[model samples]
Target: MKPWLLLGRAQPPGGGAELLLYQRDSEFSLKADNQELMNSRVYGSEEAMARLGCQNLGKRPGARVLIGGLGMGYSVRTALDTLGEDARVVVAELVPEVAEWNRGVLAELAGRPLDDRRTELHETDVAELIMAARGDYDAILLDVDNGAEAMVREGNNWLYSLPGLTAAHGALRRGGVLAVWSAVPQPAFVKRLRRAGFGVDEVKVRAHGRSSRKGGAHHVVWVAKRG
Candidate 1:
Protein backbone atom coordinates (compact mmCIF):
# COMPACT_ATOMS: atom_id res chain seq x y z
CA MET A 1 0.00 0.00 0.00
CA LYS A 2 1.17 3.52 -0.68
CA PRO A 3 2.06 5.72 2.26
CA TRP A 4 -0.99 7.95 2.21
CA LEU A 5 -0.85 11.27 4.03
CA LEU A 6 -2.84 10.53 7.13
CA LEU A 7 -4.48 13.50 8.84
CA GLY A 8 -5.52 11.74 12.02
CA ARG A 9 -5.81 8.27 13.59
CA ALA A 10 -7.15 6.58 16.74
CA GLN A 11 -7.82 3.21 18.30
CA PRO A 12 -11.51 2.45 18.05
CA PRO A 13 -13.54 0.12 20.23
CA GLY A 14 -12.31 -3.46 20.84
CA GLY A 15 -8.71 -2.42 20.08
CA GLY A 16 -9.50 -1.62 16.46
CA ALA A 17 -7.57 1.26 14.93
CA GLU A 18 -8.97 3.98 12.63
CA LEU A 19 -7.04 6.37 10.41
CA LEU A 20 -8.22 9.74 9.06
CA LEU A 21 -6.96 9.73 5.50
CA TYR A 22 -5.90 12.91 3.73
CA GLN A 23 -5.49 13.35 -0.03
CA ARG A 24 -5.10 16.77 -1.61
CA ASP A 25 -5.83 18.05 1.89
CA SER A 26 -9.22 16.33 1.99
CA GLU A 27 -9.78 14.06 5.00
CA PHE A 28 -11.12 10.49 4.91
CA SER A 29 -11.24 7.53 7.30
CA LEU A 30 -9.85 3.96 7.06
CA LYS A 31 -8.90 1.20 9.46
CA ALA A 32 -5.27 0.79 10.43
CA ASP A 33 -3.13 -0.81 13.15
CA ASN A 34 -3.10 0.76 16.61
CA GLN A 35 0.58 1.65 16.28
CA GLU A 36 0.14 3.70 13.13
CA LEU A 37 -1.49 6.77 14.67
CA MET A 38 -1.18 8.96 17.73
CA ASN A 39 -3.27 8.51 20.86
CA SER A 40 -5.80 11.07 22.14
CA ARG A 41 -8.60 11.29 24.67
CA VAL A 42 -12.32 11.13 24.21
CA TYR A 43 -13.44 14.76 24.06
CA GLY A 44 -16.77 14.34 25.80
CA SER A 45 -15.75 11.76 28.41
CA GLU A 46 -16.03 12.68 32.09
CA GLU A 47 -12.81 10.93 33.06
CA ALA A 48 -10.68 12.75 30.50
CA MET A 49 -12.14 16.11 31.59
CA ALA A 50 -11.82 15.48 35.31
CA ARG A 51 -8.52 17.28 35.70
CA LEU A 52 -10.13 20.62 34.87
CA GLY A 53 -12.18 20.94 38.07
CA CYS A 54 -9.84 18.88 40.26
CA GLN A 55 -6.85 21.10 39.50
CA ASN A 56 -8.69 24.35 39.77
CA LEU A 57 -8.12 25.38 43.40
CA GLY A 58 -11.24 27.45 43.68
CA LYS A 59 -14.08 29.09 41.77
CA ARG A 60 -12.77 32.45 43.00
CA PRO A 61 -10.88 34.01 40.05
CA GLY A 62 -7.55 34.93 38.37
CA ALA A 63 -6.79 31.56 36.81
CA ARG A 64 -4.73 31.45 33.63
CA VAL A 65 -3.76 28.32 31.70
CA LEU A 66 -1.34 27.37 28.96
CA ILE A 67 -1.82 24.05 27.23
CA GLY A 68 0.96 22.52 25.18
CA GLY A 69 -0.11 20.14 22.43
CA LEU A 70 -3.78 20.56 21.65
CA GLY A 71 -4.29 16.92 20.69
CA MET A 72 -8.04 16.47 20.19
CA GLY A 73 -9.06 19.48 22.30
CA TYR A 74 -10.45 17.26 25.02
CA SER A 75 -8.01 18.76 27.52
CA VAL A 76 -8.83 22.28 26.38
CA ARG A 77 -12.56 21.62 26.39
CA THR A 78 -12.20 20.14 29.84
CA ALA A 79 -10.18 23.10 31.02
CA LEU A 80 -12.65 25.60 29.65
CA ASP A 81 -15.47 23.90 31.48
CA THR A 82 -13.64 24.02 34.83
CA LEU A 83 -12.16 27.50 34.66
CA GLY A 84 -14.01 30.70 35.55
CA GLU A 85 -14.74 33.60 33.21
CA ASP A 86 -11.59 35.41 34.38
CA ALA A 87 -9.42 32.56 33.22
CA ARG A 88 -7.30 32.81 30.08
CA VAL A 89 -6.07 29.85 28.07
CA VAL A 90 -3.39 29.65 25.39
CA VAL A 91 -3.21 26.48 23.31
CA ALA A 92 0.04 25.93 21.40
CA GLU A 93 -0.06 23.40 18.61
CA LEU A 94 3.16 22.61 16.74
CA VAL A 95 1.45 21.15 13.73
CA PRO A 96 -1.28 23.43 12.44
CA GLU A 97 -2.63 20.44 10.50
CA VAL A 98 -3.32 18.58 13.72
CA ALA A 99 -5.48 21.48 14.76
CA GLU A 100 -6.89 21.65 11.26
CA TRP A 101 -7.50 17.94 11.02
CA ASN A 102 -9.41 18.11 14.26
CA ARG A 103 -11.80 20.40 12.43
CA GLY A 104 -11.66 18.68 9.04
CA VAL A 105 -12.61 15.11 9.90
CA LEU A 106 -12.01 14.44 13.60
CA ALA A 107 -14.04 17.52 14.50
CA GLU A 108 -16.78 15.38 15.92
CA LEU A 109 -14.31 12.71 17.04
CA ALA A 110 -12.03 15.11 18.91
CA GLY A 111 -14.63 17.86 19.24
CA ARG A 112 -14.09 21.37 17.94
CA PRO A 113 -11.17 22.18 20.23
CA LEU A 114 -10.30 25.52 18.63
CA ASP A 115 -13.85 26.84 18.57
CA ASP A 116 -13.93 28.00 22.17
CA ARG A 117 -13.57 31.73 22.59
CA ARG A 118 -11.44 31.28 25.67
CA THR A 119 -8.96 29.10 23.74
CA GLU A 120 -6.18 30.64 21.63
CA LEU A 121 -4.37 28.46 19.11
CA HIS A 122 -0.74 29.19 18.34
CA GLU A 123 0.82 27.51 15.36
CA THR A 124 4.19 27.01 17.02
CA ASP A 125 6.15 24.67 19.25
CA VAL A 126 5.01 24.34 22.86
CA ALA A 127 8.65 24.55 23.97
CA GLU A 128 8.96 28.13 22.76
CA LEU A 129 5.75 29.00 24.57
CA ILE A 130 7.09 27.32 27.72
CA MET A 131 10.28 29.34 27.49
CA ALA A 132 8.47 32.59 26.80
CA ALA A 133 5.81 32.29 29.48
CA ARG A 134 7.77 32.28 32.72
CA GLY A 135 5.47 32.36 35.73
CA ASP A 136 2.58 33.34 33.52
CA TYR A 137 0.18 30.43 33.83
CA ASP A 138 -1.70 28.78 36.67
CA ALA A 139 -1.90 25.49 34.77
CA ILE A 140 0.08 23.91 31.93
CA LEU A 141 -0.97 20.76 30.15
CA LEU A 142 1.25 18.76 27.78
CA ASP A 143 -1.11 16.53 25.86
CA VAL A 144 0.83 16.32 22.60
CA ASP A 145 3.67 14.33 20.98
CA ASN A 146 2.75 10.79 21.86
CA GLY A 147 3.42 9.99 25.48
CA ALA A 148 6.18 11.42 27.64
CA GLU A 149 8.49 8.77 26.09
CA ALA A 150 7.91 10.41 22.69
CA MET A 151 7.41 8.49 19.40
CA VAL A 152 6.14 11.04 16.92
CA ARG A 153 9.02 13.60 17.06
CA GLU A 154 12.47 13.89 18.66
CA GLY A 155 12.40 17.55 19.77
CA ASN A 156 9.60 16.67 22.19
CA ASN A 157 12.30 14.97 24.26
CA TRP A 158 13.26 18.42 25.56
CA LEU A 159 9.82 18.86 27.17
CA TYR A 160 10.51 15.72 29.22
CA SER A 161 14.20 16.53 29.79
CA LEU A 162 15.82 18.35 32.69
CA PRO A 163 15.97 21.74 31.02
CA GLY A 164 12.57 21.28 29.43
CA LEU A 165 10.96 20.36 32.72
CA THR A 166 12.71 23.31 34.32
CA ALA A 167 11.25 25.65 31.72
CA ALA A 168 7.79 24.29 32.50
CA HIS A 169 8.49 24.93 36.16
CA GLY A 170 9.22 28.56 35.41
CA ALA A 171 6.04 28.97 33.38
CA LEU A 172 3.67 28.36 36.25
CA ARG A 173 2.55 30.54 39.11
CA ARG A 174 2.71 29.46 42.72
CA GLY A 175 0.72 26.32 43.37
CA GLY A 176 0.06 26.04 39.64
CA VAL A 177 -0.45 22.61 38.09
CA LEU A 178 1.47 20.97 35.28
CA ALA A 179 -0.72 18.15 34.00
CA VAL A 180 1.06 15.79 31.62
CA TRP A 181 -0.38 12.78 29.77
CA SER A 182 1.47 9.59 28.95
CA ALA A 183 0.50 6.23 27.48
CA VAL A 184 2.61 4.44 30.07
CA PRO A 185 4.21 5.26 33.38
CA GLN A 186 7.61 6.93 33.11
CA PRO A 187 9.62 6.62 36.34
CA ALA A 188 12.41 8.99 35.33
CA PHE A 189 9.88 11.53 34.14
CA VAL A 190 8.22 11.46 37.56
CA LYS A 191 11.55 12.07 39.24
CA ARG A 192 12.28 14.90 36.84
CA LEU A 193 8.96 16.52 37.74
CA ARG A 194 9.99 16.55 41.39
CA ARG A 195 13.48 17.74 40.54
CA ALA A 196 11.95 20.63 38.68
CA GLY A 197 10.40 21.79 41.98
CA PHE A 198 6.87 20.52 41.40
CA GLY A 199 4.89 18.58 43.94
CA VAL A 200 4.10 15.80 41.55
CA ASP A 201 1.02 13.60 41.59
CA GLU A 202 1.03 10.81 39.04
CA VAL A 203 -2.55 9.96 38.14
CA LYS A 204 -3.20 6.56 36.62
CA VAL A 205 -6.01 7.42 34.18
CA ARG A 206 -7.26 4.66 31.96
CA ALA A 207 -8.16 5.23 28.34
CA HIS A 208 -11.69 6.45 27.51
CA GLY A 209 -12.98 2.92 26.92
CA ARG A 210 -13.20 1.55 30.47
CA SER A 211 -13.96 4.90 32.10
CA SER A 212 -16.89 4.41 34.43
CA ARG A 213 -17.64 4.71 38.15
CA LYS A 214 -14.44 2.77 38.68
CA GLY A 215 -11.85 3.94 36.10
CA GLY A 216 -10.87 3.76 32.44
CA ALA A 217 -8.09 1.97 30.52
CA HIS A 218 -4.37 2.20 31.37
CA HIS A 219 -2.71 5.58 30.99
CA VAL A 220 -0.87 8.21 33.02
CA VAL A 221 -1.83 11.79 33.68
CA TRP A 222 0.78 13.52 35.81
CA VAL A 223 -0.59 16.37 37.95
CA ALA A 224 2.33 18.32 39.34
CA LYS A 225 1.62 21.32 41.57
CA ARG A 226 4.16 24.12 41.51
CA GLY A 227 6.01 24.41 44.77
Candidate 2:
Protein backbone atom coordinates (compact mmCIF):
# COMPACT_ATOMS: atom_id res chain seq x y z
CA MET A 1 0.00 0.00 0.00
CA LYS A 2 1.27 3.45 -0.84
CA PRO A 3 1.43 6.12 1.87
CA TRP A 4 -0.24 9.51 1.63
CA LEU A 5 2.23 12.39 1.47
CA LEU A 6 1.39 15.79 2.90
CA LEU A 7 1.49 18.31 0.09
CA GLY A 8 0.34 21.58 1.63
CA ARG A 9 -1.64 23.17 4.47
CA ALA A 10 -3.74 26.36 4.66
CA GLN A 11 -6.12 28.27 6.87
CA PRO A 12 -9.43 29.33 5.36
CA PRO A 13 -10.26 33.01 5.48
CA GLY A 14 -12.72 34.26 8.17
CA GLY A 15 -11.15 31.92 10.77
CA GLY A 16 -12.09 28.28 10.35
CA ALA A 17 -10.21 25.04 10.87
CA GLU A 18 -7.04 24.42 8.92
CA LEU A 19 -7.18 22.59 5.58
CA LEU A 20 -4.64 19.94 4.61
CA LEU A 21 -3.78 18.51 1.23
CA TYR A 22 -2.36 15.03 0.70
CA GLN A 23 -1.29 12.91 -2.21
CA ARG A 24 -0.81 9.19 -2.78
CA ASP A 25 0.56 8.54 -6.21
CA SER A 26 -1.94 10.14 -8.62
CA GLU A 27 -4.71 10.54 -6.04
CA PHE A 28 -5.15 13.69 -3.98
CA SER A 29 -7.24 14.57 -0.92
CA LEU A 30 -8.36 17.78 0.76
CA LYS A 31 -9.11 17.45 4.47
CA ALA A 32 -9.93 19.52 7.51
CA ASP A 33 -9.07 18.55 11.09
CA ASN A 34 -8.43 14.90 10.20
CA GLN A 35 -11.74 14.59 8.32
CA GLU A 36 -11.61 14.15 4.59
CA LEU A 37 -13.55 16.94 2.85
CA MET A 38 -12.88 15.89 -0.72
CA ASN A 39 -10.87 13.17 -2.45
CA SER A 40 -9.73 13.09 -6.05
CA ARG A 41 -10.73 9.43 -6.37
CA VAL A 42 -14.42 9.67 -5.33
CA TYR A 43 -16.24 12.42 -7.16
CA GLY A 44 -19.15 10.81 -8.96
CA SER A 45 -21.67 12.72 -6.91
CA GLU A 46 -19.87 15.99 -7.59
CA GLU A 47 -20.08 15.49 -11.34
CA ALA A 48 -23.65 14.34 -10.99
CA MET A 49 -24.48 17.50 -9.08
CA ALA A 50 -23.56 19.64 -12.06
CA ARG A 51 -25.05 17.27 -14.61
CA LEU A 52 -28.41 17.10 -12.89
CA GLY A 53 -28.44 20.81 -12.16
CA CYS A 54 -27.74 21.84 -15.71
CA GLN A 55 -29.65 19.01 -17.34
CA ASN A 56 -32.22 21.44 -18.72
CA LEU A 57 -29.64 23.97 -19.88
CA GLY A 58 -28.32 22.13 -22.91
CA LYS A 59 -27.24 24.56 -25.66
CA ARG A 60 -29.09 27.42 -24.04
CA PRO A 61 -27.86 30.68 -25.57
CA GLY A 62 -25.86 32.93 -23.30
CA ALA A 63 -26.45 30.66 -20.31
CA ARG A 64 -24.63 31.56 -17.10
CA VAL A 65 -23.79 29.20 -14.23
CA LEU A 66 -22.32 29.64 -10.76
CA ILE A 67 -20.48 26.95 -8.83
CA GLY A 68 -20.05 27.48 -5.11
CA GLY A 69 -17.10 25.22 -4.48
CA LEU A 70 -13.94 24.26 -6.35
CA GLY A 71 -13.19 20.94 -4.71
CA MET A 72 -11.00 18.96 -7.09
CA GLY A 73 -12.71 20.98 -9.90
CA TYR A 74 -14.98 18.10 -10.92
CA SER A 75 -18.23 20.05 -10.64
CA VAL A 76 -16.94 22.97 -12.68
CA ARG A 77 -15.46 20.74 -15.35
CA THR A 78 -18.62 18.72 -15.57
CA ALA A 79 -20.62 21.94 -15.83
CA LEU A 80 -18.41 23.24 -18.60
CA ASP A 81 -18.83 20.02 -20.51
CA THR A 82 -22.58 20.03 -19.99
CA LEU A 83 -23.28 23.63 -21.02
CA GLY A 84 -22.90 25.15 -24.45
CA GLU A 85 -19.82 27.02 -25.71
CA ASP A 86 -21.54 30.34 -25.07
CA ALA A 87 -22.17 29.50 -21.43
CA ARG A 88 -20.16 31.11 -18.64
CA VAL A 89 -19.21 29.43 -15.35
CA VAL A 90 -18.39 31.40 -12.23
CA VAL A 91 -16.65 29.45 -9.46
CA ALA A 92 -16.55 30.88 -5.94
CA GLU A 93 -13.95 29.44 -3.59
CA LEU A 94 -13.45 30.76 -0.07
CA VAL A 95 -10.06 29.23 0.54
CA PRO A 96 -7.24 30.65 -1.56
CA GLU A 97 -5.10 27.54 -1.10
CA VAL A 98 -7.83 25.32 -2.48
CA ALA A 99 -7.88 27.40 -5.67
CA GLU A 100 -4.06 27.28 -5.80
CA TRP A 101 -4.07 23.51 -5.35
CA ASN A 102 -6.52 23.16 -8.23
CA ARG A 103 -4.10 25.15 -10.39
CA GLY A 104 -0.96 23.34 -9.27
CA VAL A 105 -0.79 19.64 -8.34
CA LEU A 106 -4.55 19.08 -8.65
CA ALA A 107 -5.05 20.71 -12.04
CA GLU A 108 -5.15 17.58 -14.16
CA LEU A 109 -7.42 15.79 -11.74
CA ALA A 110 -10.37 17.51 -13.37
CA GLY A 111 -8.66 18.62 -16.58
CA ARG A 112 -7.70 22.05 -15.28
CA PRO A 113 -11.21 23.44 -15.19
CA LEU A 114 -10.13 26.85 -13.93
CA ASP A 115 -8.07 27.35 -17.05
CA ASP A 116 -11.17 26.99 -19.19
CA ARG A 117 -11.88 30.27 -20.97
CA ARG A 118 -15.50 30.19 -19.83
CA THR A 119 -14.63 29.87 -16.14
CA GLU A 120 -14.32 32.93 -13.88
CA LEU A 121 -12.74 32.33 -10.47
CA HIS A 122 -13.86 34.29 -7.42
CA GLU A 123 -11.82 33.83 -4.27
CA THR A 124 -14.75 34.79 -2.06
CA ASP A 125 -17.73 33.31 -0.32
CA VAL A 126 -20.39 31.85 -2.60
CA ALA A 127 -23.09 33.33 -0.39
CA GLU A 128 -21.99 36.83 -1.28
CA LEU A 129 -22.39 36.10 -4.95
CA ILE A 130 -25.73 34.42 -4.37
CA MET A 131 -27.10 37.31 -2.35
CA ALA A 132 -25.85 39.94 -4.75
CA ALA A 133 -27.47 38.53 -7.84
CA ARG A 134 -31.04 38.49 -9.07
CA GLY A 135 -31.91 36.16 -11.90
CA ASP A 136 -28.29 36.33 -12.99
CA TYR A 137 -27.46 32.63 -13.24
CA ASP A 138 -29.22 29.94 -15.17
CA ALA A 139 -28.01 27.36 -12.67
CA ILE A 140 -26.24 27.39 -9.31
CA LEU A 141 -24.26 24.42 -8.01
CA LEU A 142 -23.22 24.24 -4.36
CA ASP A 143 -20.69 21.76 -2.92
CA VAL A 144 -19.33 24.05 -0.27
CA ASP A 145 -19.54 21.93 2.88
CA ASN A 146 -20.19 18.28 3.75
CA GLY A 147 -23.90 19.07 3.74
CA ALA A 148 -26.42 21.36 5.37
CA GLU A 149 -24.69 20.22 8.59
CA ALA A 150 -21.64 22.43 7.96
CA MET A 151 -18.60 20.27 8.73
CA VAL A 152 -15.68 22.55 7.83
CA ARG A 153 -16.96 26.11 8.11
CA GLU A 154 -19.59 27.39 10.52
CA GLY A 155 -20.46 30.27 8.21
CA ASN A 156 -21.61 27.79 5.58
CA ASN A 157 -24.75 27.07 7.57
CA TRP A 158 -26.44 30.13 6.05
CA LEU A 159 -26.25 28.49 2.66
CA TYR A 160 -28.83 25.92 3.79
CA SER A 161 -31.04 28.10 5.92
CA LEU A 162 -34.45 29.26 4.76
CA PRO A 163 -33.07 32.74 4.15
CA GLY A 164 -30.15 31.32 2.20
CA LEU A 165 -32.42 29.11 0.15
CA THR A 166 -34.62 32.13 -0.56
CA ALA A 167 -31.58 34.11 -1.61
CA ALA A 168 -30.52 31.29 -3.92
CA HIS A 169 -34.01 31.15 -5.32
CA GLY A 170 -33.76 34.81 -6.23
CA ALA A 171 -30.30 34.44 -7.70
CA LEU A 172 -31.51 32.19 -10.47
CA ARG A 173 -33.31 33.12 -13.65
CA ARG A 174 -36.83 31.96 -14.30
CA GLY A 175 -36.92 28.17 -14.50
CA GLY A 176 -33.32 28.01 -13.34
CA VAL A 177 -31.95 25.19 -11.20
CA LEU A 178 -29.96 25.04 -7.96
CA ALA A 179 -28.17 21.78 -7.23
CA VAL A 180 -26.68 21.09 -3.82
CA TRP A 181 -24.30 18.27 -2.81
CA SER A 182 -24.55 16.61 0.57
CA ALA A 183 -22.81 13.70 2.28
CA VAL A 184 -26.17 12.53 3.61
CA PRO A 185 -29.85 13.02 2.94
CA GLN A 186 -31.45 16.13 4.39
CA PRO A 187 -35.20 15.76 4.58
CA ALA A 188 -35.81 18.96 6.53
CA PHE A 189 -33.80 20.93 4.02
CA VAL A 190 -36.00 19.62 1.26
CA LYS A 191 -39.00 21.14 2.98
CA ARG A 192 -37.17 24.43 3.22
CA LEU A 193 -36.42 24.41 -0.48
CA ARG A 194 -40.08 23.99 -1.22
CA ARG A 195 -40.87 26.76 1.22
CA ALA A 196 -38.55 28.98 -0.73
CA GLY A 197 -40.69 28.46 -3.85
CA PHE A 198 -38.61 25.79 -5.53
CA GLY A 199 -39.62 22.47 -7.02
CA VAL A 200 -37.16 20.01 -5.47
CA ASP A 201 -35.93 16.57 -6.50
CA GLU A 202 -33.70 14.51 -4.23
CA VAL A 203 -31.22 12.29 -6.07
CA LYS A 204 -29.01 9.59 -4.55
CA VAL A 205 -25.77 8.83 -6.32
CA ARG A 206 -22.83 6.50 -5.67
CA ALA A 207 -19.63 8.09 -4.47
CA HIS A 208 -17.44 6.18 -6.92
CA GLY A 209 -17.73 5.89 -10.68
CA ARG A 210 -20.21 3.41 -12.14
CA SER A 211 -17.39 1.18 -13.35
CA SER A 212 -16.36 0.51 -9.77
CA ARG A 213 -17.82 -2.81 -8.67
CA LYS A 214 -17.71 -1.91 -5.01
CA GLY A 215 -20.55 0.65 -5.49
CA GLY A 216 -19.22 3.15 -3.03
CA ALA A 217 -21.23 5.01 -0.40
CA HIS A 218 -24.37 6.87 -1.47
CA HIS A 219 -24.47 10.66 -1.40
CA VAL A 220 -27.48 12.93 -1.90
CA VAL A 221 -27.82 15.75 -4.44
CA TRP A 222 -30.79 18.07 -4.20
CA VAL A 223 -31.83 19.53 -7.54
CA ALA A 224 -34.13 22.46 -6.85
CA LYS A 225 -35.70 24.37 -9.68
CA ARG A 226 -36.94 27.89 -9.05
CA GLY A 227 -40.55 28.28 -9.97
- Return the TM-score for each candidate structure: 0.77, 0.97
Q: What is the number of residue pairs that collide in model 2?
A: 0
Worst 10 residues of 2 by lDDT: 207-216
Q: Residue 172 of candidate 2: its Cα lDDT? A: 97
Residue by residue across 53-131, what tens digits does model 2's lDDT show? Answer: 9896877998999998898899999999999988999999999999998899999989999999999999999999999
Q: What is the lDDT of candidate 2?
A: 0.91
Model 2 alpha-carbon drift over 4 Å, by segment: none
Model 1: residue 114 alpha-carbon error in angstroms: 1.4
**Count of residue pairs whose backbone atoms collide, per candidate:** 2, 0
lDDT of 1 by residue, 1-227 (tens): 55556554443222322334443333233323434234342333323523632364447487778887665566777777777776677888766556777676657654575776767888777888999987988888887644686544556788999899899989888877888877678888899889988888777665654444565456777888888
